[model samples]
Target: MTTALKLVIFDVDGTLVDSQGDIVAAMAHAFDRAGHPAPAREATLGIVGLSLDAAFPRLAPELPAEMHGAMVEWYKEAYVELRSRAGAAASSPLYPYALETLTALHAQPETLLGVATGKSRRGLDKLFEAHDLGRFFVTSQVADHHPSKPHPAMLRAALAETGVEAHDAVMIGDTTYDRDMALAAGVPFIGVSWGYHDADDLTGAAAILRDFRELPEVLTTIREAAA
Candidate 1:
C-alpha cells in the first residue's frame, strides 16, 4: 500500500525567517506617517503572524478604525522601501539551520511542504526568490488569498490542494496564531522557539521546538504518535 502523504505546512515570517526587525520598522514608519506614536517593539512584534488589517488595529487601537486601511497601505510602502535598500535582506537573516531543516524535510518522498503565511503573495514570492527557496513548497497560501492566522482557511486550502488529510498534516510555526489555527483545523501544531513570540506563548502547540535542527525529529515523533 502507498504511504499516506505527510504535509508539513509552515509559517513564513517569524518561523522560517527572522523578519521582525524589518516588520517592526515598517510598522513604526506607518504609525509615524499617520502622525501617531510608534508602537513599542514588543507590541509590534506581538502581531507578527496576523494579517495587516487585523494587526494594525491592535497596534494602534487609539487611532480611528477607518485609518487602519491607510496604516496597512503605508506599512506596505514602507516595507517595500526598506527592502529596496542594500543589506535589508542580510539584516533579516533566517534562523540557524532553516534551509537545512527544510531541505531535510523536502528529501522525504512522502513529505510535501506548504507555506501558510500572513505575508502578501508579492512579499512571499520575493522571499522565496531571494533565498532560492521556491522549490521547497508544493503549495502556498498567502494573505492575498485568505483570512489571517488563527483562521483555518489557509490550512484548509493547503490540505485541499495537496489532498492530504488533516491527520496526515502538521502546522509548524512560532506563534499562538499558528497553534490556534491548527487546533481549529484539526491539524497537529509544532512551535519554534527562536521567533518574535516567546516559547511560552505557544502553549497550545503539540510540541515547541528549541532549535531548527530539532524539527525533523519532532516531525518524526509527531508522525509516529499519530500512527
Candidate 2:
C-alpha cells in the first residue's frame, strides 16, 4: 500500500525568520504616519499572526474603520520600503537550523511542507527569495489569500493543495493563533518557543518545541500518535 502523505505546515514570520524588528518598526511607522500613538512592542507582537485588517483594528480600536484601513496601507508601504533598503533583510535572520530543518524535511519522500502565514504573498516571496527557501514549500497560504489566523482557512487550503487529510497534517508555529487555527482545523499542532508568542500561550499544542532541531522528531511523534 502507498504510504499516506504527511504534511507539515508552518507559520513563517516568528516561526522561521526572526522578523519582529521589521514588523515592529513598520507598525510604529504606520501609527505615526496616521497621527496615532504607536502601539507598544508587546501589543504589536501579540497581533503578529493576524492579517492587517484584523490586526490594525485591535491595536487602535478607538479609530474609525477608515483610519484602520489607512494604517494597514501605511504599514504595508512602510514594510515594503524598508525591505527595499540595503541591509534590511539582515534585520530578519532565519532562526538557527530553520533552513536545515526545512531541507531535511523536504528530502523525505513522503513528507510535504507548506506555509500558513499572515504575510502577504509579496512579503512571503521576498522572505523566500532572501533566504533561497521557496523550494521547500509545496503550498503557501498567505494573508492575501486567506482570513486571519485563529481561523482555519489557511490550514484548510494547505491540506487541500497537498491532498493531505487534517489528521495527517501538523501545523508548526509560535503563537496561540497557530494553535487555535490547528485546533479549529482538526490538525495536530506543534509549538516552537522561539517565536513571538510566549511558550505559555501555546498550552494547547500537541508538543511545544524548544529548538528547531526538535522539529523532525516532533513531526514523527505526532504522525505516529495520530496513526
Candidate 3:
C-alpha cells in the first residue's frame, strides 16, 4: 500500500514568493533602459513564469536579435536593482505556515528536495542565500538554461539532477504551467491557490492546497500513499 514518491520539486517565484512588485518594476525598467516602452502589468504578469527566451519575445516584440539580447540584459540589470532594493524582503515570504511545513518535510528521511524555477540561477541563488534556505535543495534548475514552465525541461533537469523518476516525484507550483509541467513529466502535482495563476487552472492538479499550512498534511498523505 506504500506510494513510491522520493523527490519533491518546487517552483520559485509565485509559488514560493510574492515577487510581483519587484518583477513588474524591474521588467518596466528593462523596457525603459532598452528605449522601448514598458509593457503593462497584465502583459508582464501573463509572462511571469515563462522562460526568458519565451518571455522576452513577448515582452519586446519586433526587436532585432541584438536588441533582444540587450533587452534581456537590461531586464537582468533592472531585476538585480529590484532585488537589491527589496534586499532581504524580496522573496515571497512563504504563505502562512510554509516554513513550518517545509521543515516538517525536510525532517523525513529518504526525501530529496529540489527547485525548478523560472528565476535565473543568479537570482535564485541570491534569494536562497538571503533566506538561509541554501541547504534545503539538492538540485537547482534556473531559467538560464531551461525551456521554462509548461515545457517541463526545468522539471526534467531537476529530476535528472536528483536521480528521481517521474512516478516517484511530485511538483508543487502556483501556475498552470507548473501543474502542466508536472503532469507532462508523469509526476503528481500540488497546486497552490495563492500564487499568480488562477485557481480554475488547477483543475489538472492532483490536489489543490489552500495555504502552506495544508502542505505538510497533504504531502504526508501522498508520501504515505506512495509508501
Candidate 4:
C-alpha cells in the first residue's frame, strides 16, 4: 500500500529561530519612538506569535487605538534597521538542530514541509534567504496574508495550498497561540520548549520537544497513530 503524504508545518519565531533579542529591541525602539515605555521583555515575548496589530494592543492596552498603527510601522522600521545593522543571519539564528531536522524531513519523500508564521511575508522571505531555508518549505503562510495566529486561518491555508488533510498535518511551534491555532484547524500540535513561552503554557500539545533532533521520532509516532 502506498503511504499517505504527511504535511509538517512550522512556526517561525521562537520555534525555528531564536529572535527574541531583535524582537525585544525593536519593540523597545518602537515604544520609545512613540514616546511610551516598552513592555517588559517577558511581556513582549509572550506575544511573539501574534500579528503586530493584535500584539501592540496586548502590550499597551492603555494606548489609544489610533496610535497602534503608527506603532506597528515604527516597530517594522526599527526591526528592519536592526536586521540591516546586525546582518540577517546574525540577528535571527536558527535554533540548535533546526537545520538538521529540516534536512532529514525534507529527505523523506512521504513528508512535505510548510510554514505557518506570524512573520510578515517580507520578514519570512528575508529569514529564508539569509538561512538558505527557501528550499525546505513547500508552502509558507504569513501574517501579511492571513489573520493573526490562533485563528487557524494560516494553517487552513497551508492545508489547502498543499492539498493535505488536517489530520495528516502537524504544527510545531513554541507558543499557546500555535497550539490553539492547530487545535482550531484540527491538526496535531507539537510544542517546543526552547521558544519564547514557558513550557507549562504549552498544555494540550500532542508532544513537547526539548530538542529539534527529537522531531523525526515524534512525527513518526503521530503519523502511525493517525494511520
Candidate 5:
C-alpha cells in the first residue's frame, strides 16, 4: 500500500533547484579566504542539503573543532556576497517542469505544501520571489533554526507549523541527508534523481521519480493507499 501523505515538504537546494554551481563557487571563495585550499567543486556540491554552518564540518574535516564556527562565519559572509550577485538559481535554472509540478501539487486540496531546506529564510525568499514561487508555500523551514540535513528539525518545524502529523507528511529531496532526515522523522521520502546528489544518495527513499510530472500521480498513489 502506498503511504497516504497529507503534507509534502520539499528540500530546496537539490530538490527544487540545482544549486551546485553557485554553492560550489561560494564555498570555494570561503575556503580560500579561510586559508584552506578549495576542494573540488563537485565535493562542495555534494553537501548542498547542509546549512552553511553544517556544511563547514564536511569540507573542513582537518580544521580544528573550534575553527568550525569561525569557518562557518567566513563562509556565510562570502556566500552571502555571491548570493547577492549571482547564485545557482541564476545560473543552472530549475529542473525541467519543476514549476509546473509545484503548480499541480498546489492545486491538490488534500496536499499541504511547504519547504524544508538548508536555504536561509532571507535567501530562499529572494530566490522564490525572483521566480514568483514564494506564494506557493504556506510556510517554510529555513536553515536558521534547523540543524543541518540528517537532522529532522526543519521537517519537524515545518510540519508543526502546518499542523501535519509525521505519518501524513512526506519529504521530497534529492540528497541522502534529506532522505535520512525523513527516515529519522518517520515520514515517507520521495527521492528526486535529477538533483545535485547522485541516485546512490537517495537509497533510503521510498521511491524515486525521474521527473517532476510524476509527482501528482505519486501523491495520488499515496493518498489512495492511505485511504
Candidate 6:
C-alpha cells in the first residue's frame, strides 16, 4: 500500500532559527525610539509567536493603544536595519542540525514541508534568502495575511495550500502559542526544548524534541501510529 503523505509545518523563530538576539535588540530599539523603556528580555521573548500589534500591547500594556501602530512600524524598521547591518544569517542563525534535518525531510517523497509563522512576509523572505531556504517549503503562511497565532488561521491555510488533511500533518514549534495553535487546528504538535518557551509549558504536544536529528524518527513514529 502507498504511504499517506505527511505535512510538517514549522514555526520560524525559536524553532528553526535562534533569532532571540536580533528580536531583543530590535524590541529595545523600537521602545527607545518610541520614548518608552524597553520591556524585559523575558517579556519580549514570551510573545515571540504573536504579531507586532499583538506583541506590543502585551509587552507594554501601559502604552496608549493609539501608539501601537507606530511602534509596530518602528519595530519593523529597527529589525530591518539590524538585519542589514549584521546580515540576516548572522542576525538569526539556524539552530544546530536545522538545515540538515530540513534537507533530509525535503528529500522524502511522501512528506511535504511548510511554514506557519507569525513573521511578516518581508521578514520571512529575507531569512529564506539569507539561508537559502525558500525551496524547502511547499507552503508558507505569514502573519501579514492571517490573524495572530493560537487562532488556527495560519495552520489552516497551510493545510489548504498543501491539500493536506489535519490528521496527516504535524506542527513543530518551541512555544505554547504553537502548541495551542496546533491543537486548535486539530493537528498533532511537536515541541522543541531549545526555543524561547520553557519545555514544561508545551503541555499538550504529541512529543517534544531535544535535538533536530530526532525529527525524522519522530515523524516516522507519528506516521506509523496513524497508519
- Return the TM-score for each candidate structure: 0.97, 0.97, 0.89, 0.99, 0.90, 0.98
Q: Where in model 3 is the C-alpha error above 4 Å?
A: 1-5, 90-92, 223-227
Better of 5 and 6 by lDDT: 6
Q: If both were scored by TM-score, which would come out higher, candidate 2 or candidate 5?
A: 2
Worst 10 residues of 1 by lDDT: 84-93
Clashing pairs in 2: none
Candidate 3 vs. truth: CA RMSD? 2.4
Select the stronger candidate by lDDT from 2 and 4: 4
**Sorted on lDDT, highest at the top, how do the candidates line up?**
4, 6, 2, 1, 5, 3
Task: Please report, as a residue range, the 10-residue window in candidate 5 with the lowest summed lDDT.
Answer: 83-92
lDDT of each: 0.90, 0.90, 0.79, 0.94, 0.80, 0.94
Query: How many angstroms is residue 191 displaced in model 6 relative to the true structure, after the best TM-score fit?
Result: 0.2
- Better TM-score candidate (2, 6): 6
Candidate 6 collision pairs:
none
Q: Model 2 over residues 1-227: C-alpha lDDT tens digits? A: 99998899999889998988888999999999989889899999999999999999899999999999999999999888777874435867889999999999999999999999999998888888888889999999999978899999999999989899999999999999999999999998899999888999798789998999998887887778777
Between which residue pairs do clashes occur in model 1? none
Residue-level lDDT tens digits of model 4 in 87-164: 889999999999999999999999999999989999999999999999999999999988898999999999999899
Query: In candidate 1, what are the lDDT values of residues 28-72, reduced to their tens digit?
Result: 899988999998999998899999999988887888977999999
Off by over 4 Å in 5: 1-5, 87-89
Tell me model 4's lDDT, rounded to 2 decimals: 0.94
- List ranges where model 1 is wrong by over 4 Å: none
Encode model 5's per-residue lDDT on 149-203: one tens digit a residue: 7898887887778878987888898888888999998889999988878887577
Give a tens-digit lDDT track for model 3, residues 1-227: 55343788888777777788878887888788778888888788778788776788867778877877777787778778767765845434555676676677777777788888888878888888877777888888888897777888887887888778987889998887888888888889999888887877788787888878787778778867876
